[model samples]
Target: MNDTLHVVEKLTEWRARALEFEREIQKAVLGQARVIRLVTICIFARGHVLIEGDVGVGKTTLLRSASRALGGDFARVEGTVDM
Candidate 1:
């Protein structure tokens, strides 16, 4: 059916895009390959992730780097005691 063909085409395009993104991330992140790969797998597997660590441990760096690699939008939120 035409609808099926359209769906297939869209999926193919999306997969290709995700692959390209993975390559870009690999290039940007020189070290920390394991962490990066884990994050990537989590994303693809549709699993939720919680990264907790002391400050200045590259948490934001990892997210920003991944965002750039994925060619996608990135948003950062800070936790507050009141909220």
Candidate 2:
């Protein structure tokens, strides 16, 4: 019971932080709600994601914004093939 209570408290705190992170990312990137939400999920899930699309679709912008929100670095690489 004590352990469960501790977990609940931590989850609540994490949820608040996650919401704030989303808000900051949104402010930095405009007109990409779905992309932002997907990035947010992948970020908290601690997994890697491959964002692909045509040029000028905001993929790089979204990832860069997310990296800034997470206080992380962003890098871009161009490849001959898509993975």
Candidate 3:
């Protein structure tokens, strides 16, 4: 049906855009293809992500790069959980 075909076409276009977005983020955050792919999937799925790692691991850079690719602003908020 024409409607089904249209849906498929839209999905293909979205997929391409998502891939391109991922590539853009990857360009800024190097040596983390797996992390980039997972973040991209979560981003396109409209989900929130909390990245945790040791200090100086480029987490902020990854997030900033993703925000840039999304044409959005990045704000860093440091959090702590006091036991």
What are the Cα lDDT values of the candidates?
0.77, 0.87, 0.92
Where does the lowest 10-residue lDDT sum fall in candidate 3? 74-83
* Model 1, runs deviating above 4 Å: 1-23, 26-30, 80-82
5-28 per-residue lDDT for model 2 (tens digits): 999999999889888988998887
The TM-score, computed over Cα atoms with residue i paired to residue i, of candidate 2 is: 0.84
Task: Give residue 49's lDDT in candidate 2 (0 to 100).
Answer: 90
Best by TM-score: 3
Worst ten in a row by lDDT for model 2: 74-83
Q: Residue 65 of candidate 3: its Cα lDDT?
A: 94
Ten contiguous residues minimizing lDDT sum, candidate 1: 21-30
**Candidate 1, clashing residue pairs?**
none
Instruction: Give every collision pair in model 2.
Output: none
lDDT of 3 by residue, 1-83 (tens): 99999999999999999899989988888899999988988998899888999999999999999999999999988787862
lDDT for 69 in candidate 1 is 77
**TM-score for every candidate vs. truth?**
0.60, 0.84, 0.89
Candidate 3, residue 51: lDDT: 91
lDDT score of residue 44 within candidate 3:
84
